[model samples]
Target: MDKILETDGERLLVAVRNLLEAKGLVTTAEITERRAITDAANPGQGARMVAKAWTDPAYRVAMLSDGAKAAEALGIPMRGMPPLGVLENTAELHNLVVCTLCSCYPRAVLGYPPFWFKSAAYRARAVRDPRGLLAEWGTHLPEAMKLRVVDSTADYRWMVLPMRPAGTEGWSEEKLASIVREGDMIGVTIPAA
Candidate 1:
C-alpha cells in the first residue's frame, strides 16, 4: 500500500492561489475590485476612533465605557457584529488581543487581523501564559506592568491600538501608523525604534 502525505494549510492556500494565477484569472482589476468590496464592507472607521482616543482624554473614556456608541459617533458602523471594545496599552498594564475559539476581528476599525493572530499558537498561549507568550514575540513588559489578556469571542471582539511612544509628539497620523506594527496592535510588542 502507498502512504499518503499531508501538507500544511498555508501550503494548500498557496497552491490554490498559484492555480488561480496560472489561468490568468487573477488580474490586478480583480484583486482591486475584491479589495474595494472588502474595504467598503469593513472600512477603516475604527482606526479613526483609536486616533481620536489617543488625542482626547474624554473620548478615550467614552471608548472604554461605550465602544459601540463611541465607534458609531466616529461614523463607524458596527452592524451584524458584537460591539467591539478597544483596549489601549498603558505603561502599567500591557493589553494583548486574541480570539480563542474563532477569528472574530474588528474589521471596521483595524482593517483585518493578521493571520498569526488567528493561529492556534497565539490563541492557546495567549490565554495560558500571556507574559511568556509575549516575550516570545519580542515584547518584554516591565515587571510592574500587569498583563491583561483579552479574549475575542462571539459576543465581543477586541483590538489593541497601543499608545504612541513618547518621542513622537510632533509625528503625523500617517507617521504614527507606520510604527503601529501588527504585533504592537496585537499587544505582543511595544512601539519602539
Candidate 2:
C-alpha cells in the first residue's frame, strides 16, 4: 500500500482532534457539522446585516453597539466566534480592516477571508499607506476624509458598515444588499447603486 503523507500542521491537527474525541470533548460529527456551517457562510449574510441597518434605525443602533448580537438577531449564527465590531464609514471618516499578524477574519459572518486579505503586503500597506491602497482598489476618498485602519485579531474581528449610496435612499433592504460586496465590508471598495 502506498503511504499518504500528511504535513506537520495536518498531523498536529489530527492528533489534537483525536485527543479531543477520546476525551469526549467533541465528536467527529460535530466537527464536520461546524465545518459545513462555516463553509456555507458567505458575504451575503454580512450584506444582509448592513442592508437592514441602513433601513432600520433600531437595528443600526444595535449593530453599532454590538455587531455579533446584531448579526445573531438577523439569523446569523455567531456562537463560539469572537466578538465582531462594526466600523461605520461617514462622510468625513472611512474605516479599513486588516489582520496585521495573520488572517483573523470574521468567518462566522463574512465567510472565509479573501486571498488578498491574508497577504503580508496588504497588511503592511493597509496601515502604512491606507489611502494609497484604497486608491489602488478604485476607492478614492477626499483628501480631507479621515482614514482609520483597524486591526482584526484572534480576540476580535471587524467589518465595515459602508455609507449608503446617495441614489439608493428609497431602495429596499434586498436591493441595498445586492450592492454590498465583500470588498465593501472590507473597506477596500465602496458600494455603489
Candidate 3:
C-alpha cells in the first residue's frame, strides 16, 4: 500500500482489506485505485473552483447548473464518483450539507469528513435545527434568512458555494482561495476576505 498504515485504525482497515482481497470479494488493485482517487482530491481543488466561480460569472452559471462539469473544466477528476452539486449561498439563503444516513461526504473535493461531520449529533441536528447547529458553529445567520440543509448521499455529493467575502474586490484567484477553507465548503464557516 502506498499509504503507511501507522495508526491502529489504519492497520485495522488494512487487515480488513487484506481479508477481503484474500477471499476474492475484492482486490488489492481495486483498493489502491480507490485510495488513489480519494487521495488525489483535496480542499485546494474545491477552493480553486469556488474562487473561479466568484470571479467569473460564466463559470458561476455552469457551477450552479452542473457542478461535476464545472469541476471537470478545472481538471478535477470525477470518474467513478457521484455527481457533484454546488449549492450557492446567497443573502436570503444559507446552505448546509449533511449526510444523515452516513458520512457520504465529497471527499474528492473536501478531503476527509471532519470528526464532527460524521458525528450522530451533527447528522441529526443539521436536519432538525440547522440554525441552532450553525449558531453553535459560529455561523449565526439572520433569523429572516432561509437555511437549506441538503443531504449528501451515495449517489450525489453536495458542497457549498460560499458567498465571496467583502473587501476582496481585486484579489487574485489564489488569494481568494487561500481564505476558503474546507469548513467553508462544508458550510460550517465562511471564508474571510
Candidate 4:
C-alpha cells in the first residue's frame, strides 16, 4: 500500500498548479488558503446545534424527528444532496448508526469521517451487535440504556446528537464541544463530560 501511494511532491504540485492555470482561475494561492480556513471553521458548526438542543426542549424534539430540518432551523445548510437523519440516545435506548453496505456519513454535521467508521470491519460488526461493538470501543453503558442499532444506507446518512451529559447545567458551547467526541457523534458512545 505504501509503495502504491508513493509520489513525487514537486511533480504533484506542478500538476495541480497546471490544472488550476488551465482552468483560468485567479489567485490559486488565495483559493487554497481560503479552503484551509473554511475547513478549520466548518468542523465546529454542529457544536452550536448540539448546545442549542441541550438548552431547548422543542429544538431537541424537532431534531430527533426531522434531523435535516432541525439543522436548517439552526442555520446549517445541507449541500451536495446528502440526506441527514438524527438518532437520539435515550435512557432506555442507545442508538448507533452503521452503513453495512457503504459509508454513509453525515459530513455536513460531523465534518470528516473517522478512519474506523470508513472501515468494513466496523460496519459489519456494528450491525451484528452494536452493544458488543461499542463495548469493544470502550464505551460501557449501563444496562438501563437499551442498545438500538440503526443502519445508514448509501441514500441517507445519519448522525447521533447525544443527550446532554450530567452536571452540564450551565456549561458553555466550547465546554460542551470539548466533550463531544467523534465516536459520540457517530453513535458509538455518549459524551460523559
TM-score: which candidate is best?
2
Q: What are the runs in model 4 whose C-alpha is more than 4 Å off?
A: 1-43
Q: State the displacement of the C-alpha of residue 39, model 3, in Å, after optimal TM-score superposition.
A: 2.1
Q: Per-residue alpha-carbon lDDT of model 3 for 52-152, expressed as tens digits? A: 99999999999999888999899988878788889999999888999999998887688888899999999999999898898887889898988889987
TM-scores, one per candidate: 0.70, 0.86, 0.86, 0.75
TM-score of 3: 0.86
* Local error of candidate 4 at residue 184 (angstroms): 0.7
Ranking by lDDT: 2, 3, 4, 1
* Winner of 2 and 3 under TM-score: 2
Candidate with better TM-score, 2 vs 4: 2
Q: Write the per-residue lDDT of candidate 2 for residues 1-193, one digit (tens) a residue.
A: 1344445778878988999999999999999998998898999999999999999999999999999999999899988888999999999999999988988887878999999999888998998999888888888999999999998766888999999998997999999999999999989999998
- Taken over the whole model, the C-alpha lDDT of each candidate is 0.73, 0.92, 0.89, 0.76
Clashing pairs in 1: 46-109
Off by over 4 Å in 2: 1-28
Better of 2 and 4 by lDDT: 2
Off by over 4 Å in 3: 1-16, 19-33
RMSD of every candidate to native, in Å, equals 6.1, 3.9, 5.2, 4.2
Better structure of 1 and 3 per TM-score: 3
